[model samples]
Target: MRVAISRCLLGDNCRYNGKTKPNAAVIRSAKNVEVVPVCPESAGKLPIPRPAAEQRDGGVYMSDGTDVTRQFQAGACKEFDRVKKSGAPLAILKAKSPSCGSDLIYDGTYSGTLTAGDGVFTRLLKQEGITVATETMVEEMHPSVEHPVAIVLGTGLGSITDLVHVVRRIDYHDIEGFPDNAQPIEGHRFEAAIGALDGVPVIVYPGRIHLYRGYSAAEVTSLVRHAFRLGCRDIIFAGATGAIPGKVEKGLGILTDQINLTGRNPLAEWEGLRDVESPFVDMNDLYSPYMSSIARGVAKDQNITIGAGVFAGVLGPSFETRAEVSALRQLGVSYVGMSTVNEVIMAHALGMHVLGLTLAANYSGGCDVDHQSVLATAKRYEDDFQRWVRGIVHLL
Candidate 1:
């Protein structure tokens, strides 16, 4: 594969001060794959010893108050065309340059304050659908175990955390915009677990927020986004769901699709989602067929019967009424729940492969099941769930 790299990273003296920022790892990587070196500032005809520029208000400027926005844009355009014509699918860029920065840049105040913004060339490449990342994020986009699977443990399913040989832990409090005052549910855990599952790197979120808890869609699915940010590519959601009778049994299941009766979309409320090309992400194979196939094979190896069905997601702290259950049944929903789908949508939006494994805690119609019942069912299937997850991660 051909990859676009910042010219400076390849030891080119292309900076405003004519200094090159060479990266040894990036240079080593070039030995195996074709590297397309790019210097947007140089291409834009800026002098070798030109004034250092920073991104300000979506434009580039010099320290002496010269608004060289057009020069940077011209450089970006020229470099973008060259990179595009190279057919490079990936680009490793400088972290903070006004022309090559992928994620952060100077605030244009020339006071050394940093802010979230893309560089001129980087944004152009991304807008053209090329995968752009700063050198720091290169490892995540192409991990040694590509597509390392992640598990999002649902309510009563947090016990699965014990299965991980933890390498690192990130507290929910450490994440920005996370709610500190959200009411604590009995089975929920707020920390993140990062470790090896069956000798493979896997991340586990023991708790998640819900819409009924007054969280916006973004809040509810924050863990999913966090997992993706931390290098997990495949997400497996193990949650307690109510079974629709005569469809899937009161045990484990693999999701085929989902009905978002919850009437809310996490992507709808999310702004500045820069990584995605557009918010209209396709859900055609929303539930990953390849991951599901691995899960089904694993279940068969353990003599476990697995059912596949459409999941119905609703907004509720309350159980569905009988009439509501009947309506859901008519709509061909095989499992009903208050969570999972919104997170699934957000994961899909981020282009991560998804696998849904649900535990049918009870029959939805009139079981009158409480949270305790859900906990009990998860306990009963703990061993089986662990084995299934281990096998899937192994295959990934």
Candidate 2:
């Protein structure tokens, strides 16, 4: 686990006041993984304990209106690039800082009011597809609670694994291998273990409907509702996917942060919820650290090459053209796939904790598009993916 962290949070003695936030949770998580300490101010050539600054429309500026936004942005870029080379699956950054806040970032006026977005460095890291998280959210979710955990496998053989019981099994389609359409295979072998073992009530919704299935957005949204209604606080979407150019390697697991390039949205048709101003949930902090901690611990224990980064969701029945792939890569998508992002957005909007794990089945057809290769890889590594699922359940 290699994490990109704010220098201050790491007690680097480089803040404007020559002090650091240095959180205990951060220190513990860092010890579990390699830490890539970054201070955008220092990278921008600002001296230690420099004057405080704020971000304006053009750039970040000092109190006297000296423009430092360009320097800050450039410094952030350097740190972002440096951390990307480390290949750590996760990143823990400081929240509400001018450079590292995840969701409720400073309004850039230094007014002390958090707006509905992310900080400069956070946005850049997200664009680069890093699994960005804040220290505080992790502490809140993971606490020291003793929750039971279970691991589940997907696809056909996924139904049978090492488990004492099956909790629930869901087959989106009614086929011989699966049972019904709506109430299909409830409390089957797999889901039974998820509940019996995890104590958090685990249920599996296998064979999701894609854009190719002609499924309506609202119809798909109902699945998320059902998951939350089942007393499931956290929802994880684990599936097979194809790797995008420059973002990921084949046969690895990717934890996505956010997705919006696709025109489709799960909450587009949802009504009666004015609680959130928009149907789109701010994904600056999309993947939950609570879930990520479990993933990291499991990956370490099982020796899985779990790569976490930004996953760009494309509305695809058809794979992207090379030009399209190149465009998405420039946009900072580490991997391109069909599922998970939309579902994650819906889950977050509905106030459910969401985490996504994507198996890079094969490289997207930049020079090669082999369905045979993709399936072969998925088959070869199914157990590895299953083990990861089990780890998540165990930690839950």
Query: Top TM-score: which candidate number?
Result: 1
Cα shift from native, residue 153, model 1 (Å): 0.6
Report the lDDT tens digits of candidate 1 across residue range 159-272.
Answer: 878888897898887766567776548777988888777677778888888888799988888788777776777788988899998777898899989999899998887774
lDDT of 2 by residue, 13-45 (tens): 878777877887677666655568888777877
User: Number of the top candidate by lDDT?
Assistant: 1
Check candidate 1 and list the clashing pairs: none
Looking at model 2, report the run of 10 residues with the lowest lDDT sum: 143-152
Model 1 Cα displacement at 216 (Å)?
Answer: 0.6
Alpha carbon lDDT of each predicted model: 0.80, 0.63
